[model samples]
Target: MARVTVEDCLEHVENRFELVMLSTKRARQLATGGKEPLVQWENDKPTVVALREIAEGLMSYEFIAEQEIVQDEPLFAAFEDESNEAV
Candidate 1:
């Protein structure tokens, strides 16, 4: 599709909220260079490519749900050095 609309992606995902979350997650993955786009490269940004992937049935709720959400900065980072020392 020329433009990747939410309606197009809705077929794969049930609700608009989940669709947004899934697309956002996919976009993050793309931005981080963690995964390659399942669709062709049209020089589009990460967000656009993510939406296109969803519209083309390459991305789905299951795919997003299975991925482990890793935090960039750990919540308890301050204790890391102490925890690593011999005890």
Candidate 2:
């Protein structure tokens, strides 16, 4: 089996941390059977499939960032509320 290196995926992502986060989120989605992978094989795990997708530019960083922003809105709102209460 071929290993997917971070270097192979760097062109698709801005940095290693973002790559890791995106790949891991995709892997979780695959693990939960959320969607069919862009690339498919019998033996590869979800994490491997995610890395392959990243390396192949099948996933967009904008999509990931948007998802993160949507997910974080509640936390940000709560922080704002707390600050307002303190003021």
Candidate 3:
């Protein structure tokens, strides 16, 4: 298997925020004990599973920036509430 770099994982994480958050939560769970690695593919490419796996562990709260939802106050409040509920 090829070596997985941190940068590679981070790029994916930035682009796929929701998946990264889910994977990060899973990665933390999997990291507790000695466990085997899981396989994950990137756009049909056989990426280094380890990098994507580690990226999941390193997920942070990400804000999506788009035209319709970038500066909406109500959306921000709702999102904040949702985040609080998640915690």
For candidate 3, lDDT tens digit of each residue in 13-64? 5555655554554444345533345554544222234345555554333311
Report how far residue 70 has shifted in candidate 1, in Å. Answer: 6.7
Tell me how candidate 3 scores on lDDT: 0.48
Off by over 4 Å in 3: 15-24, 33-37, 40-50, 54-87
Residue 83 in model 2: shift from native, Å?
22
For each candidate in turn, give its C-alpha RMSD to the true structure in angstroms.
Answer: 4.4, 4.4, 12.6
Query: Where does model 1 exceed 4 Å of error?
Result: 65-87
Q: How close is candidate 3 to the true structure, as a TM-score?
A: 0.28
- Encode model 2's per-residue lDDT on 1-87: one tens digit a residue: 578898999999999998889998888877884667888656988999999999989887665554453463665797899899998
Q: Best to worst by lDDT, what's the order?
A: 1, 2, 3
* lDDT pick, better of 1 and 2: 1
